[model samples]
Structure formats: C-alpha cells, structure tokens
Target: MARARSEERRAEILRAALEVIAERGYRGASLASVAERVGLTQQGLLHHFPTKEALLIAVLEERDQWDTGGAGLSREAWRLDLLEPLVEYNAMRPGIVQTFSALLGESVSDGHPAKDFFTERYATVRGGMGAALRAEFGNRLPGGLTPEQAAPLLVAVMDGLQYQWLLDPESVDMPGAFRDFLGLLRGAGDGPRG
Candidate 1:
C-alpha cells in the first residue's frame, strides 16, 4: 500500500510537471504553478525535486522516456518506431510537441540541459531510424544513398509536419503521410536526381 501511494504520487508529479512545461516553455514554468497543478505546496514539490533546474531536467528526461518508452531502440530504427506514435502524440499533446519544437531552438546554446538531451536523443533516434530503413529497404535504395542518407530528411519532414499539423491538423492524413514516406524510402533506389 505504501509503495502504491509512492508510485502514484510520482506519476502525479511527473504528469503535473509535463503539463506545466507544456503550457509554459521551459523557462517560464514555475514550481508554484506545478505544485498547484498537483495539489502540493512548493516545499512539498521540493521534496521530490530540489530545484527548478533539476525539475526541468527531470521533466526533459521524463519526456524522452515517455516518448521512447524503453524499447532498447536502435538509432537506425527510431524513425519507423516514431511513426505510429507521432500522430497520436501530436493529436493528444500538441502543446508538448510545440514545447519540444521550441526547445530545439534553445538547445543551440552551450550548456543548456536540452542540448545534451537532444544531442543524445537525436543520435539514438537517428540511429534507430537508419536501422529500420536498412532493415526494410536495404536492397531498395540507391547504390550509395543508404538508409543513413534518407533518415535525417524523413525525420525532419515528420517533425516539420507536426508543426504544420498543429497549425491545421485537418490538412494532414497521419497514417497516409507515413505510408507515403515509406513508399518514398522504398523507392529510394532511384534516389533524387542531380
């Protein structure tokens, strides 16, 4: 019973943190606001995370974990894995998607927490997406293009598409878009002409 309560409180805190961060960019979120969201006092929240930066770091790590869900994912196959979840993730939490997009800009600065987070995150995801592509179309791509060549663009498109969908979701056909992506990747043997 005690363990259950602890686990429940942890989840509540995590969810509250995500909501606060999603609503307010990483810089704007206040501990007071997050505590209120979870019915805890600021000091109470402090018991869980000692400082705002630490909490923000926790939030970023949690988002990455929640986003990836521990699949021991190969960087090469990350894009394929992201495919089924991206549409749902975008529809359910456009704010989170927006927050992630916004963080990319911030990550350019030296020593930003998200800088390391995204650097590792992208490396992992890129590797997984590349692996997935090679697995599916190893023989279908250009003589030299390889899955690595196409992985980045495909990821960029998906990320960009999320922004577009957030602006006008009705314009996107989520599954069909992914299907077309696969088709293009499969036909990459023809590759893009010079």
Candidate 2:
C-alpha cells in the first residue's frame, strides 16, 4: 500500500494547492504555503512535485479531470443537454471555480506558465463546442452564424458567467443564466419553455 499512500498524499497536496491558488492566484501562491497546508515541509513538497510549475500543471489537469467526470477527455461533441448540468455542478464547487477564474485572469499576461495551457485548452474546447453546435444545428445555427462563429461565444458565456457568479453568487444564477444562454444559442425568441 505504499503506492496508495503516495497517491493519497499527492491528492492532498493538489487540494491544498488549489486552495492556495484560489486565495493568492498562481503568481502569488508559494510552494511553502501549499506544503504547510498539506502538513509537509517545503523540501518534502518539492520531492513530490519537483517544481511549482509542475504542481500547478497537476492542479489544472485535476480540475479538468473533475470537469470531464474522470472519463479522461472526449474529443467527440458534447451533448447540448450536458451544459446545464455542468454549470450546476460548477456552482456546487465554488473553490474550484474560483481557482480556475483566478488562474485564467492571471494567465492573460505574456509568458505565464498557464498561458500556453489555457490557450491550447481553449482551442480544444472551442473545437468540441463547434462540433456540438454543428451536430445540433447543421451548417448554421438559426441566426445565420456558423458553429465556428458561435463556439467562441459559447466558451465566453460559460467563463463570463463564472466570473459574475464568483463576484456575486447571491445575484447570479449561473446555471439558470447558462440555460438562458443555451436558448439564445438555439434561436432568438426561443426562451426556455415550461
């Protein structure tokens, strides 16, 4: 069970790192802070992660794995129905959402470690979204815009809603707002039906 214990410790470190990153953003979070959270010395933490960048990458990948339901990632188009549930799921995990938002905001600058990761991730996410839109609406999604055009908007809405919800959770109904956006995606004047 040595391997099992090692894996558990690593997961604990990642959770601690997420909390630190959520509080301090990627640039400000230090390995010592994460190590202390996991009851380890800084050198001990280094033994596991080697470097802060490696730990950050692990945290990001873990977040993605959680988002994708641990099925690894599916390149195929996501079903339109899954979007709302995903948003609702996100609402239940405020820490993860905050960490993601914090990293995304910080990654906009030049040469950030996460800059390339987010850039590549968005391209893949956009492609999946475009495929989903095309599968649902064929060449053009009711508004005369192609799926390629709408895909980025879809990503924007999801991330934008997260930012709004993070700022004022009491005011932003993230899942509901996302459902409304999906309606807009489907067609104008096609608001959610009872």
Every candidate's lDDT: 0.70, 0.84
lDDT of each residue in 45-115, candidate 2, tens digit only = 99899878678778878877777777434557366678888899989877667767877887899988878
Which candidate ranks first by lDDT, i.e. highest? 2
User: What lDDT score is found at residue 73 in candidate 2?
Assistant: 47
Clashes per candidate, residues 3 or more apart or on different chains: 17, 0
**Model 2 stretches with alpha carbons more than 4 Å out:** 1-9, 16-30, 50-53, 188-194
Q: What is the lDDT of residue 75 in candidate 2?
A: 52
Model 1, span 1-194: residue lDDT tens = 98898778877887888877777755567889889999999999898877776676666666666566654444532546557666655666766666666677677899876688678777777777778778766834643468888768777877777767766878876545665665566554333333
Q: TM-score for each prediction? A: 0.70, 0.81
